[model samples]
Target: MRSTNFCLSTEGADVILATSSDEKYPPENIIDGQSETFWTTTGMFPQEFVICFHKCVIISKLTIQCYLVQTLRIEKSMSKDPVDFEHCIEKDLEYKEGELQTEEFSFPEFQATHLRFIILSAFDTFVSVHRVIAEGIAQDI
Candidate 1:
């Protein structure tokens, strides 16, 4: 297992849902399905919110042969409308320690009652993720 060499931080009320040891899905607040979960920053977001994918450290770097955004969906509590933001932050990479890293993904107008990160593929090494920052708003909506 690669040591935790990177730091994970966020701007909003972030939560960490570690999936290294759990055999089944985490609780509702953290996860809803395999490689899927609902993330909330202020805990009291009424309808829409903005989320940012900060940073992820690739220990082996080789583990993740490829990184791509599989899906991006926007959810609202009072409404049943779901919008997609997967293409909001055109996927890009940065170089660090001979590894191609992921640049921060920030959605300026990501509307959601809740936020989530859906992992499409698993890397070769034991990966640790930082917190996803999401902010709820009423004025924006």
Candidate 2:
């Protein structure tokens, strides 16, 4: 059978620590399948969060929805634990007034069990990450 793309969050994906947390706007909101809910920065710049897939996933495309963020970086790891991640992509996002910033990345071939998103900086004092979606094929293991 041919492989098909699907959202990892719907298949038992979860976010790791090293992320700013708030009860009303927790980091889990980034993958909670709710657009109105988002994870907000509780402190200074260079905030980040790691997402762990339930299993090995070959992701071809990744999308992140946020606002006021100026620079961001994505890293990936194939190990069982959320460590030893290699640099994947880094890009600066454009600011849109009163609008959410949607960033999409298409990879040639990326296999990972964990993904880490690093927010280098933002246009405002704080940033809000609405959601993170990974589209790919999950491995049989």
Candidate 3:
């Protein structure tokens, strides 16, 4: 068994994980004039389990309404080389003016030690979140 890492963020808002700088995830294959080196997390977990994140690094009480597209990935690993998982950050949350919408997602089972959350778009400057949860179970293969 391995571990997993988690990353979550809000749109238009910079975020700092563990003890890093505020960085935003860029759009897929789109680079207008934003920073390329977005911040992400290292291996934070090492087993099948659930991790919850209710607070987005940025602390503000603003909400918006928009569509969300979240993506979770597992890096390739070779038996000869040290097992290292690379979960790319994705733009998930979406918002328009000042409304709230829910986007629920589940990932296929994988042995990872890192997780990253990316906020695609939002209306305002802050991200409004009530509760965030992560659950992991053994894969039946």
Best by lDDT: 2
Candidate 2 segments whose C-alpha is farther than 4 A from its true place? 1-9
Roughly what TM-score does model 3 have, to 2 decimal places?
0.32
lDDT of 1 by residue, 68-105 (tens): 22222322222222234332222323334434233344
- Count backbone overlaps in model 1: 1
Q: Against the true structure, what is each candidate's TM-score?
A: 0.32, 0.92, 0.32
Q: Which digits, one per residue and each the tens of the lDDT, describe model 3 over residues 1-141?
A: 432122223222112222222235222201111222222222222111111223222111212122222222212221222234354323345444434354444444433333333343334333323223233332233
Which ranking of candidates, highest lDDT first? 2, 3, 1
Per-residue lDDT tens digits for candidate 2, residues 27-61, read: 87888877798989987989999988858988888
The local distance difference test score of each candidate is 0.28, 0.85, 0.28
Model 3, 20: alpha-carbon shift in Å? 9.4
C-alpha RMSD values across all candidates:
13.4, 1.8, 14.1
Error of 2 at 41 (Å): 0.7
Off by over 4 Å in 1: 1-102, 135-141
Decide which is better by TM-score, 1 or 2.
2
Instruction: Show how many residue pairs clash in every candidate, following the order shown.
Output: 1, 0, 18
Superior candidate under lDDT, 2 versus 3: 2
